[model samples]
Target chain A: MTASVTSLVNQPYKYGFVTDIESDTIPAGLSEDVIRLISAKKNEPDFMLEFRLKAYRQWLKMDEPTWAEVGYAKIDYQKIVYYSAPKQQKKLNSLDEVDPTLLETFEKLGIPLSEQKRLSNVAVDAIFDSVSVATTFREQLFEVGVIFCSISEAMREYPELIQKYLGSVVPVGDNFFAALNAAVFTDGSFVYIPKGVACPMELSTYFRINNGDSGQFERTLIVAEEGSSVSYLEGCTAPMFDTNQLHAAVVELVALDHADIKYSTVQNWYAGDANGKGGIYNFVTKRGLCQGVNSKISWTQVETGSAITWKYPSCVLVGDNSVGEFYSVALTNNMQQADTGTKMVHVGKNTRSTIISKGISAGKSENSYRGLVKIGPKADGARNYSQCDSMLIGDTAGANTFPYIQVQNNTARVEHEASTSKIGEDQLFFFRQRGISAEDAISMMISGFCKDVFSQLPMEFAVEADRLLALKLEGSVG
Target chain B: MISENSPIILSVNNLTANVNGTQILKGMNLEIKAGEIHAIMGPNGSGKSTFSKVLAGHPAYDVTGGEVQFLGQNLLELEPEDRARSGVFLAFQYPLEIPGVSNLDFLRVAYNSRQKHQGLEELDAFDFDELVQQKLDIVKMDAAFLNRSVNEGFSGGEKKRNEILQMALLEPKLGILDETDSGLDIDALKIVADGVNQLSNPDNATLMITHYQRLLNYVVPDYVHVMANGRIIRSGTKDLALELEARGYDWVLDEAAAGVA
Candidate 1:
């Protein structure tokens, strides 16, 4: 890890270089050997390796997706480094002996971490780059029969639970990205909120991309048993560099009878230079399953940074009377290209889903809204409603909407509405004559457009999302 | 510089404008002098609103010919913002709502923009608030409106009142009310007219563009120019507005085309 971070300061990024770390890298290609090597290095049992090898072979047969509303050169699989771990850093038994740099990094990212004098019962696992650095409050959580750790750690510690629920929601051959992630995924989060237990506090992941070229492939599995509920927040950022970095992560969520899960993300990856030279190509797949009766799942995201982003955090309403929701505000500035929305699939009776998406495109950026709502034959009395709107700041920018609805049941009802508009100069003059500058005028217009989605976030996060939109669109007024 | 007969604070000569190759205003000419309020009355497509938009430097309309002289300099030469800074306020027929920018913040920017252009010190938030509070009373606008987004979700009457409130804050040399009385009710119209009445003076002129004489009945105009086919065909006093109101527009259309020929 030290040499990779150091040598990165000098080497040209596009020209891939293999830095010396205790990396469990195979011959820089995806095949049966690579998957087996990866599973073996993690000390996984033979069954897991077979699953990975199957996923790897399936990924090879599948073509890299070209359907995303973004542009990039073809990815060379032989060039990507699959795995790396920290050298000689001991996994501490107590909080006092944890690596201070890891703690300091989380603190700089503004993780509120202090032992509450009385109620410090929340457990936290700080995952930095490709490794899980520290897991806090484990002893207390264990006393309550709770299990929370990294996915690799979960395989070693609680194999039975992992075996039962691992591939149930999103199997090994879910999609091109998911299959690739299943084969090469390094480290992510594993959380199991036990039956009838409500998590005392929010579980958070502050993800950062430090090493260049090496993509961070994280897989998060969140399971809420019957009558359980949990809320999780994921925040991502990266060090500023002048090359396009890649981050492909997959997240799966499951909620059983009467369980509820709320997931929110603030993705602020490095969004390239002003001339669109370098940034992060962030492609992520996040989905939740309402697995049993009366389960509820919701996704809220504020995406402000990325060179090219293709993501949809979605939900499948599989259980009877379950509810699904998606609230999002995706802002693209400069030369950024963001194509994001959500999908809600209704397969059970009396299911409900709601989606509200607001997109802002400025400069030469292109922002799109693509979503799907499907109601199966048995999903009688299913109801779905969606509202998507786009606000373009400059004339050169673009906004497009593609909503796919598949309803096979007459008893199911689905409604969708979308509109695209430019913030006319007349609006700015109207504002200027009132005493606002051009920039503030645009900022206010965008925030108002996004208020419906922003209000869904927590107070601090809502304010942060609003400010990020302003900062991302500074001077984008043509 | 404006004489009594031609209190022409704004003079346009052989003006022509087109939107996307379709001519809207062709060789139109009109003038408004200091202190006097002139009403431009015409049919829907007779360039009444286009005149206001062209004067305010809307980029979509191509100013194909002629010039607009305001005070002394060319009005078309200035950017819309600079025209605004130079005290030319156009009360749009459809006022745009800019959400998130508070009415107070917008007013301060407009206030300080003109002050800064005139080489005067800008007013801070507190002092500016005090100043705007007094002016809001003149428009009968609620003090709470200051915290809301400019013109956002405002009633039609409130939007007109807000436009006048901005005019009051900027104190422009030339104030053009482009169909300000269109959506106003009888009571709202009276309040708006009264707001305009209080702000008028010998040095600052007003040009009200209207489709009906009912608005002129309240905010009585000193001159009434009948616009026909993009040109001002006739000019007279308050009685002219009454005659046009009585005669309907068909006579003007016939007589003005004959007069032009």
Candidate 2:
């Protein structure tokens, strides 16, 4: 019985096929000239070039941080390709200008990019390798004073907005990965919701990594002006290879007075084979800033892939009466390692935040939740509530929790709760005695355990997240 | 209520079982006919609980040498779930609590599993809700329990009532109550016994394992058997229970030993 359960989760990776096409890939290495070449390739403005140079100089002096609980082989910075993009003839004016093969690739991944097959309510910005291929509903969104386009296009069209808010929330020398991403991030999504305008449709971005040895560094920035609101989501996937790939991306969000921003992510990158031979190393930095009074920002993520994951999506409350929330569900199986959670920092009076995290580990994997909740001295009556739960499938797996809380104000209130559970034989037997198959039993229990986090997702994506978790944990327990 | 020509619901022959390499059920033999209620009384460590577990095909118990026939079919060949769907239900003495799974959902799933096995149409959430509400009256359970996690934070009597509630929903052919009377107060015991008595009919059989004779006062049994050393040594009508309750099991054990000598 145990052997059969172990074999259940050993299913092969589905999105492991590479697309064959002509790609303009740079040589493997990183330096000041590489950053300059990348900036020149994108035709960036002088100020943007200066920003990249400053970040590159700072990155040269910083060392890779070893504070996370994940272990891996040393990453040789000089042996990675900093830039890779599909070769195009000229600048794209619309979706018709996209390559047919590239559109076919996205279609096979269940993300239709063409006008005839695109989703009705969602406007997607499809990013392939290191460039944005196409963005849907651009004309409709433009008519309402909403600017939704590739970051490169925004840098050219709305340069003032980019120059003002770029690197404001996360500066050039914030951390190792953020600095590296600031230096050479090729393309990502850029959204600007004008004052008092609730964007007409849902905005999304789909990222696909195709090159074998090239690193993927994308940047996304969403700014909701006063009395405006926007909900955005992102998805990621990569092909399988013998050697591990590096993915270091940065996402920053800013919400002004009476504004709201909700950001969600469904990351399904290719985890290595059963022997842990090949996969992606995902290290990302994402943060949100409630910059004006009564602003709100919420982060929800469902992470199920990557051989080693190190990420912490955080929120900084800088305005009185602002609110921040983080809801996440992370699953790891078959020798995978993850150290992921959230951080909530209260700097304004009467600020509020909530964090709920669920981690599941199976097959000899190691999963950890490391979170922090800090309250400033002047923030009177600030409140925070955090709960972290971990579930183990087999006896060989490991689960850990490290929660750090710091409160300086005398009136601040902070509460933390955590628990660990395993899928024991008795639970399965009880279900079996009730005529339920083991497969159905395990899936039902898992879906129940993740109910709280799934409820925070958007309507359509909530169903997808539930199904994805069930598929990932099939036959993984007795 | 038993007729001489009635069908046999279960027949166990020379049943020998072991748990973790230690033999528990040694050469146990028994036969239960339709419409019959049989009670087995035994001292501790006499393999009473192991008998119910073995019949339910628990993974912990290994049937070394045994032949179990249910409705003239080889019962040992089926899996635990198949045994359940084919009309064998064991109400656990200590029901396991499953967190986050509501009682209504669990009952509906189990009912649908049996329905699917019998080649019948399964009930959706709306219809299953109506059906389960009617079944709740048998055990006198409140409607609020339908939304709570299955047996999680439930009182001891509430858990036992839930077991009987499942038995009502599944409607099995042979019902085995494994010391269901251990942790119930007198009021709860009467309610549970009334539930068992109401579920009894001309087509189903009941096997109750207990340590006290108080349960028999509510749901009277036709026969009472005393089990010792992993096997039944003496059997008689309901009068045997009255005698055993008056004078403990030592006299019976001595008589069985003298007969063996």
Candidate 3:
């Protein structure tokens, strides 16, 4: 019975196909000269070059932190390709000029970059390897003063915005991976909602890492001015390779007074084979700053891929009466390891934050939820509620929860609840006795366990995330 | 309710089973007709619950030696789910609490599985909702319970009612109530018993494993058997249950020993 269920869910990664595009890949080395070349290659402004140099110097001074529960071989930074993009015309006026092969690849991944076939309500910036290939619906967004484009393009077009909010939330010297990303990050989506104007449609970025030898360092930044609101989503996938790939990304969000920003991610990178031979090392730094009164930011992520995932999408609530929320569902199967959660820092009076995290572990994988909730000294009347739940599929799998709470103010209230459950034999028998097959039973229970987090996702993304989890859980029950 | 012409639904001969290498059911024998309700009254460790679980093909119990036939099919050869699909249902003594699975969805999926097994068209959500509402009336359950997770945070009585609700939805040929009356109060017992009575028909049989005569007072079994030392030593009508209730099983055990001597 377990074998049958395994056959149903143990499907090979469907988005693991490599695109046959050529040229414009930098040498496999990192140095001051390489950083200069990267900045020179993109025709970046002088300030951008100085920023990269500063971040590189800081990264050189810092050591890779070893506090995470996951273990991996020492990474050799000098051996990675700092830049790789599909060689194309200097500029693209329309989707027709884009490479057909690249367009077909995104289409196969269920993300159509072509304007005619793109999803109606979503404007996607499709990023390949080290650069944005195409960003759909730019004209429709331009009408509303919503600046939606690639970060590199934003640097050339809206240099003022880039210089102001580039590393405002997640500074370049914040962490080891963030520093590395700030130094060599090439392309990611940029969204700026002007004051009082809600984004017309959902903004999204679909990242595909096609090159095996190069590391993907994409930087994304979203800023919502006062009284404005925006919902952004990100999706990622990579081709199968015997060699592990490095993906270090930095995402920052800035919300002013009365602004609301909802950011969601469905990360499905290649998680290597069942033996845990090769996959992507996803180390990301994502943070949002609620900088003005009554501003709000929420992070929702469904992570079901990567060999090792270590990141915390956090919120630094700096405005009075600001609110923050984090909803996440992380699933690891077949030798995968994920130590992911969120952090909420309250520095404003009357601030409130919520954290709901669900972790599912199967096979010989290890899944952990590490979170922190901190209330500053002057943040009177702050409140926080956090719930962390873990579900294990088989006896070989493991789950852990680490919740840290610091309250410097007496008026602050914090509540935390956590639980761990396994898909026990008796539970399966109960379903089987009701004539439901093991495959259906496992999927139903999983979706039910993840309902709270999945409900926070966009309608279509929720469905897709559910299916992705089911597929990843296949063959894990034996 | 038993008629001489009624066909036998289940036949057990010299049935012996083991759980964790310890023999639980030793040389048990029983036979039930299609229209009859048989209640097995026994003390603790008398193998009453084990018999129900073994018949349902529970993984924990091993049928070491047994000749069990359900409608002339070898029941031991089937899997737990197959046995359920083939019209055997066991309303658990402690109904497992499955958090996050809505009761309505659970009932619909179970009902649809049986429907598909019979080669019938499965009911969609709309039709199933209407059907489930009608079945809810049999157990006097509120429609509100349907939206909640299966038996999650349900009171003892509510969990038992949910079991009967499932039994109503499945409509099995042989419904085994394994101590379903243990945790309920008088009111819940009456409602559950009424549900069992409503679902019982001339074409199906009920085998109840209970320790109390309270449940029998409402459902009124056609035959009551005294189970001791892993086998039934005496069988009689409803009067036997009242007699056992009045004077525990000590007399019956002495009588059975005397007969053996």
Which structure among the candidates has the greatest TM-score? Answer: 2
Native-to-model Cα distance after best TM-score fit, residue A18 in candidate 3, in Å: 2.2
| Local distance difference test, each candidate | 0.79, 0.90, 0.92
User: Chain B alone: TM-score in each candidate?
Assistant: 0.96, 0.98, 0.98
Tens-digit per-residue lDDT, A391-411, candidate 2? 888677889998999999999
Candidate 1 Cα outliers beyond 4 Å, as residue runs? A1-27, A94-125, A135-146, A240-243, A476-478, B1-88, B97-174, B181-195, B198-205, B210-214, B223-261
Looking at candidate 3 chain B, the ten consecutive residues that score lowest on lDDT are B57-66
TM-score computed on alpha carbons, candidate 1 = 0.77
List candidate 2 stretches off by more than 4 Å: A475-478, B21-23, B225-261
Q: Tell me the DockQ of each model, to 2 decimals.
A: 0.31, 0.69, 0.65
Clashing residue pairs in all predictions, respectively, total: 10, 0, 2
Say which prediction, candidate 1 or candidate 2, comes out ahead on lDDT: 2
Alpha-carbon deviation at A91 in model 1, angstroms: 2.2
lDDT of 3 by residue, A1-478 (tens): 2444445446688888899989699899999999999999999999999999999999999999898889899999989999999999997889879999999999999998887888999999999999999999999999999999999999999999999999989888999999999999999999999999999899999999999999999999999999999999999999999889999999999999999999999999999998998899999999999999999999999999999999999999999999999999999888899999999999999999999999988878899999999999989999999999998876778899999999999999999999887776677778888888777788889999999999999887889998888877654433
Q: For residues A234-322, write the lDDT of model 1, one tens digit per residue.
A: 78877767777778889999999999998888888888866788788888888899989999999999988878999988889999999
How much is A334 displaced in model 2, in angstroms?
Answer: 1.7
Candidates ranked, most accurate by TM-score first: 2, 3, 1
Ranking by lDDT: 3, 2, 1
For candidate 1, give the lDDT of residue B193. Answer: 94
Single-chain TM-score of chain A, each candidate? 0.89, 0.98, 0.98
